[model samples]
Target: METKNITGLTEFILTGLTHQPEWQVPLFLLFWMIYLITIVGNFGLIALICNDPHLHIPMYLFLGNLAFVDTWLSSTVTPKMLLNFFAMSKECKIQFFSFAICVTTECFLLATMAFDRYVAICKPLLYPVIMTNRLCIWLLVLSFLGGLFHAIIHNAFLLRLTFCNSIIVHHFYCDIIPLFKISCTDPTINFLMVFIFAGSIQTFTISIVLVSYTLVLFTILKKKSLQGIRKAFSTCGAHLLSVSLYYGPLLFMYVLPGSAQENDQNMMDSLFYTVIIPFLSPIIYSLRNKKVIDSLTKMLKRNV
Candidate 1:
């Protein structure tokens, strides 16, 4: 095994969204529109939070990071998929190193955002003190660092693998699942690595979020005014929506065993996380946020 020559795979053939020739154009247009909206919505949210003074709280700070992550996350897979949709033949080479970087970064960013919410809700009195500007900046830096660390390890393992035969990946992008399917060597170690790292991150983050929300609920229930409880719940509504969208498809895709039917089902679920969720996240956050609406209204009034 040590003496085996590691030759770089030249190209990979992506099984585009659908095999049907008739569906190509329609699917292309639909995802193209979604990609455009995702970029605009996420960037708009980031700009709104950055430029507006009133939106400088920990919540909005986290929202801005989420927007930034969503922007890159969608960019990583959608553009390539869109281009493939328009192509006559779906052949592409995903630089494994580049893909490893993208996926790892996204995972860390999601975990960081979960921790931000935990701090904001669980320690409201000390939120400002605990999540100072310096601290937030450090958190962002650490998130990226965590991604870099994981990506290095993942890519290193991938580089060691010898792929001499199949190069066709049956997915829209360079995800680990599809990539593992094409590996010529035994993938038990690779599968275990993904299970340990990805699974641990998801489980730990979800636990923190659940604990934070549980405490928040208990606190809200203690308030005498129903209006206060309602208001608090409304504030958290968008976060809950985001959490569900992100975790739901993730659990479905990663936790379950891949079967013949799972391929198509997984692709659709991948669309939910990669396309629909990113596009909807900013809109959900903005619409549910009273401050964002007020700020936008004031800006429009001043411009008019």
Candidate 2:
């Protein structure tokens, strides 16, 4: 009954990643460099893949999309975070909505990439027939739509909650967990929904990746050529490292007990996925890839 007198929240005060004045400038500069590199790396990858006819295969196509997603994923949070370090704080639904979509899409895309690897390595003879262009298009569409559906479900539930008291969000961005903690309304159902949808998405995607890699492993074991086995392992190694980096923090942040996810730790985890991963992804994909390097060298020579 006493709650009737309280006013509703129109805006939120984000506490951001850190409160120390001295750390703000350095952090801002660090993330500024990261954001710039992420944009350049991802966009550069996209351009390279799109222009090179030799790279017009399922692997490069998926890598291109992954780059695109990583760009948006970093953009959605890092700018806001950079501003927040200077005590400029603002919140909006668009930021969270976009971030949610990118995160989910990336998860599905990773799984799709894993399956692509499985087909290429485990069923090398049928790789061309099995991974048709139509199938690739469908997979991409499914990832985007899956992300859209997940985002809609969470946002719908979030709209029902009331924020009466503190408008100060404990983290840099407007994340679901932090919002839940600050809401005056009971977030039991929201948390439950997260457990169902988010958990299922992560679990399902991880399973696909694991199963695909396992099959690929078995296929490699049977191969007579040691060279083929090394090549197979090398191809999968980049993706495995990427998956570990991308999913490890997410599992820790979302799947684990809520008791373990303190604000500071959660912010750090978020930073790893949202900032560090995006910057690292293109490098991971391109560093050891002879084709990408060769294409780059050719393009540079032509321009020069």
Candidate 3:
């Protein structure tokens, strides 16, 4: 029997989205457009938040951080995915850290935004005091640090794995599950870390969002006026939308075992979490939130 202990594998051949040659060019065009739009929209959001004095509050501050992360996350994954789309053999390899950091950061940041929303709605009178400028800055710093810490731990364990057996990764990016599938040695420790951090941490964040929303929901329900309900939903609708777009696919991808995701579905899920969500998040905020729309309109009109 061939020993699986050999550890000299320096590269991996990513299977990308499909084996069908006919689909590559069309898919490339699609993602390329999506990437361009995401870049434009997210950067515009960050700049708008920074420049508009009325928008410089806790919510927008959190949103600016979200926008910045979304911009980089999309940039990090999509460009590389686009590059693979045109590769003649549908083969490419990328650093494991890029996907790790981007996804991990976004997870913590989303949770932090949930907390921000919680302060705004659940404790409306104390919202300003609770989410003060100093606290907001610290929260942002914590989100970044938490994400980097998760990514470092994840990649550190991953770096120890010997992938002497399979160099063909059956997915788009260097996602945790995909790497696990190809690892030659026993991935017990790696799996355990993911179980503890990815599973526990993701669950903890999702719970925070859910619990916060539950309080907001009860508050909205107690109000007899329909307008009060409308107001509540409007305040949180974009957030909920972005959360669903983010957590739905994220839970699907990471929560399950690696083998559960077949190649095609894995690629599509990667495309959604890495590419589509980043694009959709800004649009969700800008189109649905009146303040952002008003701010953007003024800026555009001024430019004109």
Count of backbone clashes for each model?
A: 0, 0, 0
Winning model by lDDT: 2
lDDT of each: 0.73, 0.90, 0.79
TM-score of each: 0.89, 0.96, 0.92
- Model 2 shows how many backbone clashes? 0
Write candidate 2's Cα lDDT for 1-304 as tens digits.
3553123444678888888999999989999999999999999999999999999999999999999999999999999999999875767566778999999999999999999999999888999999999999999999999999999998888887888656788989878888888788888998888888989999999999999999999999999999998888888888999999999988876666375667898888899999999999999999868789999999999999
Residue-level lDDT of model 3, residues 56-92, one tens digit each, is: 8988988998899888888877776777765622222
Best candidate per TM-score, number? 2
Which residues of candidate 2, in runs, are more than 4 Å off? Answer: 1-10
* lDDT for position 257 in model 1: 34
By TM-score, is 2 or 3 better?
A: 2
